[model samples]
Target: MTSQSISTDVYEQAAAWLERLDNGPLDKLSKRRFINWVDAHPTHKQMFESMLITWSSPTLERALADAKQTITLKDHLRCTPAIRWWQTAFICTALVIGVIAWQLTPNQPSAIVHQYATNTGEMRDIRLEDNSEVTMGSASDVYIKFSDRHRLVNLKKGAAYFDVTSNKQRPFEVKIGSASVVAVGTEFNIDRGQYFTDVVVHEGAVEVAGSRDDKPVLVKAGEQIRITGRTLGLVQSIDISRTVDWRSGWLELDNESLHYLVERLNRESAKHIRIDSPALNDIRVAGRFRLKDPGQALNLLAEVYGLKIEETAERYTITRLP
Candidate 1:
């Protein structure tokens, strides 16, 4: 083969490799090798660049969509020639696009994608392009995708308060587990935890529906609703402003038990607090406490209930005094 042909083959291989890398973690040695290769020759770099752009072209994306449609049936995944051929074609197209996106992206210190995560007892505020804002709660990870047609956010895990900008033409939506919360203009909090998914509406209105085949229920201001994967229940009334009091460094514990309060505090603060006594679950506490300083709250808890607070490497425990 001529030198030109060899270079073309290398570029093709690079594109395929990049597409695969998009789906998984990159090995350090392989990444180093690719970097060195790109730096070695100008012609080789041009070839790689050309290949990347071609693969990510609109034409390639359309081809991939066509390929996806062909493999939609379960029977297609079985050992069959037709399915195998379609998969091969689809994978090839995807590689072409993947290479273009990866190679074209600037080589900066933040090479890999940076995912946003909120730690226990910490809340993070993120601003979106539409001038909307999201206040994420502890242990939350959210991915945002904005386009002309829609503003989408995937609440992969945890909870977040979304103060969305009103856009009647293109609605804003959040996907959590099997439920989706849609709003044209609203401020709401969506919680996805072990028990159930909760949507607390603070402003305007939001439509909550199951991701699968269920119809959505519309929730308005000062209302909250909980949905178990399949069931969408009634909307309960709430003190909208006070419900999200944590945003301003205050925890509104309205007849909440010491057990639940600890859970809320753990989520609101960067501390992992555990209640050692089961009896504390029945001890109801209602008050507004500033979340800025957890130490002061601990001191108050100790003084009120004569409880002992112990801190360990992994967690903090509160136990009743003997």
Candidate 2:
């Protein structure tokens, strides 16, 4: 099949998956199968992520299936070379809609800006005057600046989700580390790690840049872009549900590094969790683990990987089981 046909088919399948998920809870097997489907194609995950954001309203349920119910996506392709993006976002918007990052850069001129933070093992949600919403992950810190000129959120550490209300006149912007993501009206996620910054666009589009001199790259819905100390990295597809699963108090991993996973989990725990072996970073991990109970999550990790856990007065250490 042509690439256009393939894209349509993926959207159709993504709509079906979103419908299934909305109808009921997703079991482990189903979640695993879904992950495999996303892994099957890079764009597949991005498409799914986009759908997740578009379907945020109750009015949009089954919007995708209905869009092509009698008049299927394939039927439309018979006439047009490709479907329009607004139509795509509209159809996909009715698919995965549900509920809806960062750092500290300088605070530009503003009327009144504020700071928000989440404590260890805490998650907080904030609603801004512009109807924008922000969800901060554990131990995250951010600064907000709202001026007549622009909307800004500075993420110093941890992660956050920005569901920005549209205002073409005042574009929404996020600053994390040395990176900046700008959007007019959109929903996106940003993770400012110690080493790198990750940005995922669940809806709308984003422009990412390193600093003033660095050129910006556009990141559309269903796509993700990342960068470290350098300028913008390559934009890529992402699994939206997996990316923001923390919103539901769960962490979903797909062969993710144990060390990396520990680093995130550490933010939610009073005592830091450390890995003695760097090779542990290679261990493939999967499944949905809760973030509320770090102890339970760590215990499951130890059991799953057959690793020894040494709990000292000051630290929690993980090592290969003897």
Candidate 3:
């Protein structure tokens, strides 16, 4: 290929990697591989770093900045439209980079594990090789293991809503902590929360197994289950639609702790929201907050709950009102 063609390819590849990182979580191995890709070519590093800096705040500029730079990315990554360079690159990157990442081997072993994750407050929708769909929530990591035997998606952290396309020969399973959720052509939401793994089935039934010694419990549609570590908890029925509201860009809280609510609200914004007093952490809050304006919601919370908010360019802190 010509020099221009090669340059285009490299720029495109770098943009695609940045896209994957933004669209979903970048696992440690993938992240390392990306760093290697950046290091191998100065152009790759420049494009990647520029795109990263454009989308994220100034804080990440240092992290994405290369030790020794070559070309300036202002010409390639950004356009005169005042468009966000990184956002465009991210959504478009997935269209390419298919052949580079995953290749099917005749003898697929469990060793071929692909890890994916998202940053704090970022949610992603990704499709698996088997056509299974995964919607990942913020601060989440997923390990995908597709072997000759079975297809597994391990929710290492946070939450994911799975829409499995049926394959009788290979059952779709999601591993959370020590528990495994098994399903066949089903739709369900699994949340790896701070204390427990919450499961809600929407379309089909799933067998939830916490431990090898424990019996696998069948949780059907409209049913919910919670487990922590390797221990099982009670199965209850819930409104599946109401629970997965975050997918639609709304956070519904009903007497939730102030600390927890603050965390969720923070995810919707670039600003870090902190509770000034530990005592305020346990204060219960109830409301339906829209993701469109998290700061507005925070202000409303402060006003209603008698909380004081302190703002800075870096972050926003919430303290009890005198």
Q: After superposition, how far is residue 110 of candidate 2 from its true place, in Å?
A: 5.1
**Per-residue alpha-carbon lDDT of candidate 1 for residues 80-100, written as tens digits (9 for 90 to 100):** 543454355455445543432
Cα lDDT computed for each candidate against the true fold: 0.65, 0.70, 0.67
TM-scores for every candidate against the unseen true structure: 0.58, 0.61, 0.62
Better of 1 and 3 by TM-score: 3
Off by over 4 Å in 3: 1-111, 241-244
Score candidate 2 by TM-score against the native: 0.61
Off by over 4 Å in 2: 1-110, 239-244, 277-284
Ranking by TM-score: 3, 2, 1
Backbone clashes in model 3, listed as residue pairs: 25-117, 25-118
**How would you encode candidate 3's per-residue C-alpha lDDT over 66-144 as one tens digit per residue?**
3112112434423422224333433323222221232232343423456677887688999988889999887777767
On lDDT, who's better, 1 or 3? 3
Candidate ranking (lDDT, best to worst): 2, 3, 1
Clashes of each: 5, 10, 2
Candidate with best lDDT = 2
